[model samples]
Target: MTLFTELRRRKVFRVAAAYAVMAWLLLQVADILLDNFGAPEWVFKSFTVLLVLGFLPAVILAWVFDLTPGGLQRTPDAAPAETGVTADSGMAGREQLTNRVILVGALLIIVVMATERIWFAGRGNALDLPAAAPAAGLAEPDGPPAAADPARSIAVLAFEDLSPEGDQAYFAEGISEELLNLLARSEGFRVAARTSSFKFKGSDADIGEIGQALNVETVLEGSVRKAGDQVRITAQLIEVDSGFHIWSDTYDRRLENIFSVQDEIASAIVRALQLELDVGVETAGRTENVAAYDLYLRGRQLGREPSRAGLLRAIEHFEEALTLDPRFAAAYSGIAEAWVWLEDYGGVPSTEAYPKAEQAARRAIALDPQSAEAHAAMAFVRQRYYNDAVGAARSFERTLELNPNYVTAYNNYGDVLRDMGNLERMIEVHRKAVELDPLSVFMRTRLASKYIDVIRFDAARELLDEVLAEYPDNDYAKEELANLAVAQGRLADAIPEYRLVHFSRPGDPFSAAMIAIVATRLDDRALAGAWIEAARQQGENNRWELLARRPLVERDGDWAAMAELGRVTPGPEGALLRGTAAARAGDWLEARRLLLEALQLDGYDATQPARLSHMRTLTELAWVEQQLGLEDWEDRAAVVEAVVEELRRQGAGSIDENGVSPDYVMARLAAMRGDRAGTLAGLQAVWDARFLSHWFLATDPVLTPWREDPEFIALAEQVRAHAASERAKLAGLEVLP
Candidate 1:
């Protein structure tokens, strides 16, 4: 007999086919289960390896063994001449039995798969909502998780521009965003954030995949066409699971009636979803002028671009829109957002940008009291610019009340909370923002930075790893990783991460500035000088240059130059830095005056590295008071103690940033109080954590008394030697300059 015929008779082919099919199905099930259970990659890799290794063994066993109804038996060799009726009858009976067994196994697998789908659906494996209830002001404290009503969640995709020239893409996006905003305002409905939803624009992703990515149950998508004074919009709401149309509509309207058309579409969606009429949307902050609306949309799209030039252009478009429609509240809010970002991201001075932002935000609020975007912008300005925490908090609360799904409000409010020294509340607010916009690398990285500040190293690393895995080239993610290393006192690991960010964003001065500061802290003056020159070459005369120069100036004991440099710097940082330099220069009266002015300008900022600066200012002010024999030194020392106590209460007592630590302040206080044991203990803790900068340790006035102590001498020498060794490792490497 032919080899193929012999194999068929022995059922080897059937066994191989069944094994292949079963293995594929098993792999699919394994992938889902392993991912859901958060299994490590090695576990799945080993499972796959074992399965592949077993394939040959499984086929060999099929060749060697056979099943019989009467008893267990090895497969009998095929007979050369079995031409009898009984032989044919026996073969047919065995074949029927084998088929029945295969059928039962397949059905069992199907049943298991179906049950798993239902089980995971109930546990929110598909929706991927946070297990904890959001404690941000938008939600009740410790309320049920938002996942409980994930069935009501929806994503609004960017509508396709079907205009003849395809030049109305921005208009189409604006319509979709407006609808998204209106739906998000609904009381009980959950709408995905714009950043997460718009990521699928022009993608070939199916509705189900988009829904899964955004963690939504429904998807709204459409096409828009505009020609002269007429507009046509077609929209459909699709059920993600079934890929079925839940509702659809097409509208042909004059351009002037676009606002009403949006209102009607939003109301129809609410009705189709069976949402209450009381929770329906209102057409607030909308303009009737089509030309102005187009300009507003263009401005918003440009504002999202991550560049200074783009922001400047966006402001121009927003101004044009406002000129065409003076009462365009949304346009004013857009302008406010652009100005705020110009300072925070685009290298503009806060003095120049914050006022413009506040003015535009005020105009928007005046035009429409219920505009959530307006309130959010004002809140950002109040906190980040004016440092008015109470006003910012109230504005954030009102913004959330108007639109509970305003992700930016939650994000900025989290910053306000951080500035107020409420780390726990800040994290809570950030979590809510992440839940609303989970795919935003910016939000995730920002939260990771807070984790680093609080010394939650593992949590911070996990978030950064997740972001880097998807966005390998993200400069912000790399910077945060470097920040994490610095917080942990891993100076060696941090330098390369900062360099990576510098290389990726060669035109940005921020990373070069960081590298210079880090090199100075390591006592690598040559490398520091190279990076400083590189930063200067970046061409923007921003705060980074002054910041990068401070440490090098202090290292040289050129207090006069340091003070002069700080005077030119802006804000409380500059004042405090100038004050510290003046004190080191023996100008106690000038130091005290500058320090008090600094405190008056901004009481305190509880976020790193600003927190470190604040701590430094208070410590130096206390020391200056002691030099001038002022009793107020006691009050400043008391305030420092209170801040330290608060940090301990928050479980972040060990927080360190860029070689600065609260322990340094405590050690100084101990020495001032003549507590030798406490002073040594604090110094030991700082040494153990590698949180000492060599120059600061060498020059500190409080430490002058301990200079003769053998242990203190050894600690300082060890830190100096470590910094020298780390610097020596890069001795011959070419630097930026």
Candidate 2:
């Protein structure tokens, strides 16, 4: 018989066919299961090796064995009679078994293909699914949507360091960040902010959960192994909801080809997501020099820590990068960014740090005008230091134009809008920032602050509470909660909150000062004095010293010292302090001038009465006008009344608007008009709102007319009693609130 005919009779061909199909099926299943479990690539290699080894053994076994009615036997030993069949019958039986085996294998192959098709189709649909809307009431009406289209949204997680010593973590992170920046710069791609993505660096959280938190549909994760000049990068694009890999690749190249590897990974991702890459679009890597790139990445890693020492170290690294490659725009931008933080963290005076930052940023732009980081650095310097609101806005616009997914640009721009008294725009920008960086505590806190600015107290409280629950040690969120409580006239609630922050950051002058302010308001003079001393000891003679002394200025009549201190202060807050000092010293004319100057500095105008500080400034100005004379007070009083009424109509229903308790203003107005009932009513409101201090009611010049009234005395006692109870409660806390 022919060899093929002999093989068919023995069913070797059917067994080989079935073995091939089964091996393919097993490998497919193993590949998926191993990847899902995050098994090392070596595990897959081992699986493939075992499959190869089993193939020869299965073929040899099929050649040696035969099917018989009695039992299995060697092919040469089997005879038709011993098997209780004739040659034709035995051949027919073997043919039927072969046909059945072939049919079953074909069916299994079909089933496997169908299963794969179903899985891939489901994953594809998940990628295209519309993003889930933000929780109801969490989004503002005019704000940007909470999530972008899923097909175009992605989050690049920090890559793992698989180097021999596991010491290339910074290099892996830098590569991931570059990929994120590239995707962010790509048209129609919405990438999660660095802060949000890096939050999952060491976490074992499910990819689907991470995707939901960051508001992205796809996630790119990878690992890097570097040895000397050789580097291997393995990256995979995953459908977040299904946790299915859309594409995966490993690039083995020299360090000099790192930029090319990055480009290849980005292109692979674009293809996997079915995105159209724009022609001539630049990728994120700028420097071809590996040393300079490494230094720049280290600088960026250090810059994330917003501390004086951290920024200083970041600056050093960035400067070293510049020395290596002066034309590297990213390095220059990093220097500019580091300098901005240096100024912010009090590492350098704004006057010195800002100009240097502007110079570095301008140089970066000159080198690479399309750089989003360059534009963002310029915007930050202009907004925070130069106060050039128009220039800052233009820079911010250019920044977003270059990289629409730059969350920090949005966040910084929101601050500019806030400083310019554009609450709506501020809220809108901050909402977008939070959307892009949903897992970022800093971003969420900033959004909450904007919510508070718009008087959406419940929303602000909810957001702050959520952040605090997740990150209980977050001082910024705690501080915002305290501010919210103070704004609501809940001083007792605010005091404990501020004390928590104070105890946590005992050396932070701002925290100590806030505690001092709240303590004084609670009538705990000893506690207030202790905090004042604490603040003074912690560099209270510097630019931040004014905050530490503010409580004393308000409680005691220390106007002369405050005025001297204010002469060196520079900003709206400084002007307000000077005005208050002038007012307390009985210089109404100077107070009126300084107060108006303060209002102008704060961007206050009748047309924009929605500014949080506007009503407060107007109230102060009206009080100063009343002190000037009753004859000249009508115009000022009319203006204040008009603004207050406008704000009330705008939903700021609080009697105390943005920290200016209107009780003092109302009592002054009533006293001037000789309205006895109005005077008593205003005092009663003050007591109810916890705005009145016992010393102010007893000795203030404005309330002298009603000092002898029985009802006014009773209101003063009520305020004092309430203060005492709060003070006692605070004292019971172990933290010395």
The 0-to-1 C-alpha lDDT of every candidate, in the order given, reads: 0.76, 0.73
lDDT of 2 at 613: 48
Tell me how far the alpha carbon of residue 75 in candidate 2 is from the true structure, in angstroms, after superposition: 19
Q: Give the TM-score of candidate 2.
A: 0.75
The worst-scoring run of ten residues by lDDT in candidate 2 lies at 131-140
> Clashing pairs in model 1?
none
lDDT of 2: 0.73
Listed in order, each prediction's TM-score against the native is 0.75, 0.75
- Tens digit per residue, CA lDDT, model 2, 547-608: 55655555675777778767765656667778878887789888989988887766565554
Candidate 1 stretches greater than 4 Å from native? 1-151, 274-281, 533-541, 604-614, 653-659, 729-737
Q: Tens-digit lDDT track for model 1 on 240-259?
A: 88775555556667787777
What lDDT score is found at residue 81 in candidate 1? 82
